[model samples]
Target: MIGHVGFTVVVIILKKEDTMRITGISSKPPLLFTPLFPTYFFPTHSDRKDENTWINIHYVEQIKPLKDKKCKVIFVDDQTITVNISAHSMHHQYLNGIYYYYMMDRAARVATFDPDSPIDYTKPQLNIYEALAKYSLFEHK
Candidate 1:
């Protein structure tokens, strides 16, 4: 189990999944349920195995810093919650979630790319190939 906070429980049944290899996130990685619509949920605390709140990165509207290194997070639906973490840290986590989503989406695209399929010259894909090579993403092959 990932953890349980309040009434919410997160459990991953997959065994020895390489989340870092697939998502490029080393710590406190956001959870992505579906690749069709990539929405990431990030933990409020550092440890994922601890009792911490998980917030959807897409729904966060604003983060207000409070005293004692805590912050209040406001959602797009006007719901708010006070978390025991600094606003800076919360914002950094939010950015990390976005980065994780981008990497996942890119990986999906790369995996689905067919060498035999006709390329769309109108939309150039050379840069993506170059970036993958530079990062050694295809080195294992």
Candidate 2:
């Protein structure tokens, strides 16, 4: 819009307004589900075996993306087990991201990640924080 004030000219530009957004990027879709906390608990009806570990995880305890990026993290909360994944945005088509390894202690809702080993998808992941927010260690934090 443009208006005239005496001999001066004034212009106004307008932009659309949307509130359901994380930072400047709209959360339309494509929120990747990756684990944040990696805790190890003995699987039921299973025996302890090798020290070799698989990588498939099942839940996201804390979600931390780049301050200005839209990427979302899905991880479980463990005592000493943790996974460190590095990515650019909160949204992507998968594989266009980067990830490394970390140690964690608690187990949340996650399947498991095996970069070099086979996994049983028929099993269910368990995320207790999400199930019991009030009881979660991160309740107020």
Candidate 3:
């Protein structure tokens, strides 16, 4: 049977090498827990699996702090869950989740390009000025 460390290793492997690279760049190495899906789930507490509470970044509507140093996370569907973490800490995790999501998205976009695809030479290429004019904010008469 695979132990905890073995399971974690498998997860890291499945997540790809980019996860480690991103963790290094962000200066926040995922310790005991890493996001199952970077864009979807993030742990409010990452130190221990027993204490960790995963939240869906997309569904989070608001985070409110309680008097006892905990946070209440409200979801888009009006569901709320109180986690034993400070509001500031929870917010930090939320922001980190967003950052990871964007990083993974950018990596995916870059990795999907087909270098061998033939470029259509018949289509005229637009210069910087023409491209800017075409997408300019100001309306043209």
TM-score for each predicted model, relative to the true structure: 0.63, 0.16, 0.59
Off by over 4 Å in 3: 1-9, 12-18, 25-39, 47-49, 113-141
Across residues 1-141, which tens digit of lDDT does each residue of candidate 1 receive? 334653243333220033455566666766655433434778787554465787888899999999999999999999999998899989988887887766655554565474334323245444455334324442334
- With candidate 3 superimposed using the best TM-score fit, by how many Å does residue 77's alpha carbon deviate from the native? 0.9
Question: How far does residue 58 in candidate 3 sit from its true spot (Å)?
Answer: 1.3
Against the correct fold, how does model 2 do in TM-score?
0.16
For residues 10-45, what per-residue lDDT tens digits would candidate 2 score against the true structure? 110000011112113222211212233322121111
> Which candidate ranks first by TM-score, i.e. highest?
1
In candidate 3, position 48 carries an lDDT of: 46
Question: Stretches of candidate 1 above 4 Å error?
Answer: 1-18, 47-51, 114-141
Q: What is the lDDT for 4 in model 2?
A: 69
TM-score of 1: 0.63
Cα displacement (angstroms), candidate 2, residue 59, comes to: 3.5
lDDT assessment of candidate 1:
0.64
Tens digits of per-residue lDDT, candidate 3, 1-141, equal 899999976765444334445544232323213322224456766434577766767889999999788989999999999998889988888876677666544443344343343222235662343223222312222
